[model samples]
Target: MSHHDNKPPKVCIVCGMPLKDKNDYPGGDTSLDWCKYCGTKDGIHPYKKLLEGMAKFLQQTQGMSEEESKKAAKQMVDSSPAVKMGKVKVAE
Candidate 1:
């Protein structure tokens, strides 16, 4: 069996961010599958909103061009655990 078989995933399902603390979760709910940036107490953000936020963060942190950051964000979200598990969907 996998090491994490019975444990919560160590990474956010939506953005693939490392979940290191309760503060990293939405409303400090450690049982959440997504991160603070990817969701709220209500639910996960819509796909476009999630992508835009991630792209902006990538551009700011990585010094990437707007187009490049958007591309990277889309790729990251598309391959995220949430998407793979059908918890989140990305349209091509």
Candidate 2:
């Protein structure tokens, strides 16, 4: 298969370590290059859609209020192991 057709090799942006399946880099936006750990440390993800959907799902599935759902989503994103290590920063 061509390089484009093959799955991108996962690499930790922080330490440049080869990531395992359990530590698969979150794939959503190209702009956010940092891995999960680093992303969390920086506080933001390339794809807000995934985070928003996760928040909505939590709210609907758990019968949480809008605010609560939002909070839950934020927490999930904040606590992500990848975010903590990836340290991705959104450009201004």
Candidate 3:
């Protein structure tokens, strides 16, 4: 089997959220590339600002510490394919 099999998604390309299982979040399928908060079967869930909000989301939802959440959010965003391709900008 490939390395992808049985492994949960690492991160989201559109919103930079660390994804878990397909049903772990409300709208995500995990079988896809982005998280439920960022996308759904129909289309993307639009958001204006992300940098701070992502960190806040992680903290509030996952119980990550303030500093840890910020750091993790930054890392995910910086490495996402969408960001690399200029399709998304967390700071904007």
Candidate 4:
């Protein structure tokens, strides 16, 4: 079965944006195309971006040349709920 078959249909966890078509999320999962108003709400988008970036940095850098630093960063990133909320941008 496809990945989508296992998980429930995608919806914005915060704003209930329907993830059903290209207009909703042109780039698919990574698009993170929530309702326009929700995506632009004060202190939401930027914070989300920051958290997402941190998580990505941690995940990618983990167990690399600087193991300790990587681990520490990963720990910090994983500890924050916000960092875990955003969908990761998958490479195309």
TM-score computed on alpha carbons, candidate 3:
0.47
- lDDT digits (tens) for residues 33-64 of candidate 3: 66666556664443344556678888998999
For residues 6-86, write the lDDT of model 4, one tens digit per residue: 566566443345556544543333355453323443233454453454445545756434455544544543443334565
Rank order by TM-score, top first? 1, 3, 2, 4
TM-score of each: 0.84, 0.43, 0.47, 0.28
Of the candidates numbered 2 and 4, which has the greater lDDT value? 2
> Model 2: runs farther than 4 Å from truth?
1-47, 87-92
Instruction: Name the better of 2 and 4 by TM-score.
Output: 2
Candidate 3, position 46, lDDT = 39
Which residue pairs does candidate 4 place in steric collision? Answer: none
Task: Supply every candidate's count of residue pairs whose N, Cα or C atoms clash at under 3 angstroms.
Answer: 0, 14, 1, 0
Which candidate tops TM-score? Answer: 1
lDDT of 2 at 32: 45
How well does model 4 score by local distance difference test?
0.45
lDDT of 1: 0.85
Q: What lDDT does each candidate get?
A: 0.85, 0.53, 0.66, 0.45
User: Relative to the unseen true structure, what is the C-alpha lDDT of residue 12 in candidate 1, on a scale of 0 to 100?
Assistant: 87
| Collision pairs in model 1 | none
lDDT of 1 by residue, 5-82 (tens): 567657888887887777899998878878899989788887888889999999899999999999999999888888
For residue 84, what is the lDDT in candidate 2? 69
Of candidate 2, the 10-residue stretch with the lowest lDDT total is 36-45
